[model samples]
Target: MRLLLIGPPGAGKGTQAVRLATHLSIRHISTGDLFREEIARGTELGRNADRHIRAGLLVPDEVTVGVIRERLARPDTEPGFLLDGFPRNPAQAAELDGILARTGSGLDAVLHLEVPDAEVISRIAGRRLCREDPGHIFHVDHDPPEVAGTCAFCGGELYQRDDDREATVRRRLEVYRGETAPVLDHYRGQGLVTTVSALGQVQEVLDRALTAIGRAGSTPRTP
Candidate 1:
């Protein structure tokens, strides 16, 4: 099933996206990965996108749309794909519709993971990352490291990134609310949105998401 997954940063959308795509046997596509792939391959579009990114500016819609267009053209997407972090606003959503319309196809559903702003702040602000290895992430509440203010792996200093600071996280939440509200509203008008609570255990959320989408028995099921 062609699907769009939308949620705030701390809503565990990334984890759910991977699980849903795996269970459904579909590609899990995120714009950040796409951009990284492009930049790593040193393509012209990648260079242009990199320039904008280096300048701390949003990549132009045309560039972003082009990236998605090329990705969707791949043979792998023929079966299905779970999209994340694309079509960030209504304008991009319209562009996505045009792209799919050309091929006589469109999204089957848009899964929205709902999380309260207070919870979002708590979840993000407590995050700590290892300076030596960004992958070594720890949460003050959910998963603290063996030693406080340090990473279990590599013995690196664990620091809360500026992006994860309370103030910055709030700012990000505000931006998400302002931009994605209209996109969600637009999808609701088209009757393609499925709202799901993004709380509880990972397995539980995964089950809930699958059940919510599969109520129509539309998406393929894994054996």
Candidate 2:
């Protein structure tokens, strides 16, 4: 499926994207992961994105769109892809439309994961990441490690990310409301938007997402 998954901080967009992509056999194309990969490689785009990311600001639309365009052009994405974290505002949404038009492709569904701001704050505040692998995530309340401040997967030190701090999470929510929320409206007008509660167990949420996508009338492509 060609999907765009939207959610505020702590809404588990990354986790859901990974799960959904695996189930549908589509590439999980996350802008956050793209930026991290670029930064880790020390590419020019990564250097530019790093500065904005460090300040808890959205990366510029041009740079973000450029990266996404390059990614979508790749052969692996021919099957389909689940997009996360790009098109943060109406302008970028329009840019995406234009990009897809040139390739005769467009989103099949846009899933908006809804979670209350208070819940988002609480979820993000307790979150921890492994120093060795950011993928090894834990929540102090919901998914704590066997030992305090340790990663269960890699035995790396686990610590809360700076962006996961309460204040930063609030800021991120503010940004989402002011910026990302409108992108939902942009797609809603196209009759391609689906709203799903992001609460409950991971598998439960994933099931809801799958059902929502199916109801939206886009069958997953056979792998």
Candidate 3:
């Protein structure tokens, strides 16, 4: 199914997107990941996005929309895709509609992960990461590394990101409330949104999301 995943920062939207996409054999597209890849490559788009991302601000609509269009046009996305961290507000949602309209396709569902602000703050504040490979994530209180201060994958030193700090996480959450909440309402008004509780274990939350979508007929179980 072509789906969008929307939630506040620390909402585990990325985790659910990855799990759901793998389970359904669909592509998972994340604008955050896209920006990171581009920035790593020092592409024009990446350079433009880097400054905003570093400051925990949303990338401008034009740049973000262009990147989403390019990703949706890829071959791997032909079957379907689980989109995470795009269409962050009403404006982006409208732009997404235009992109889909041009492609002669439309989104099947929007999975809205709902978690309380306190839970979100707790989850993010305890987060840690591998300095050498930021992709490797851990939680200091919940899921620490095998060896303290070391990554299980590359032996990289584990550290906390400035963006993941308490103050920064709070700022990100505030931005989500101000900017992304409207996107959720837009999808809800279209009757295409399924709200799933994202408060349990990662796997439990994933199951809840799948069940919610399956009941909505967005995902069909295969024999």
Model 1: per-residue Cα lDDT over 6-99, one tens digit each: 9988999889999999999999999889999999999988998999999999999999999999999999999999999988999999999989
By lDDT, the best candidate is 2
Runs with alpha carbons beyond 4 Å of true place in candidate 1:
216-223
User: What lDDT, from 0 to 1, does candidate 2 have?
Assistant: 0.90
Quick one: ranking by TM-score, best first? Answer: 1, 2, 3
RMSD of each: 3.3, 4.1, 4.6
lDDT of 2 by residue, 113-199 (tens): 999999999999999999999999999998999999999988999999898999999998998999899999999988888999999
Model 2, position 153: C-alpha lDDT score: 88
What is the lDDT of every predicted structure here?
0.90, 0.90, 0.86
Cα error of candidate 2 at position 161, Å = 4.8
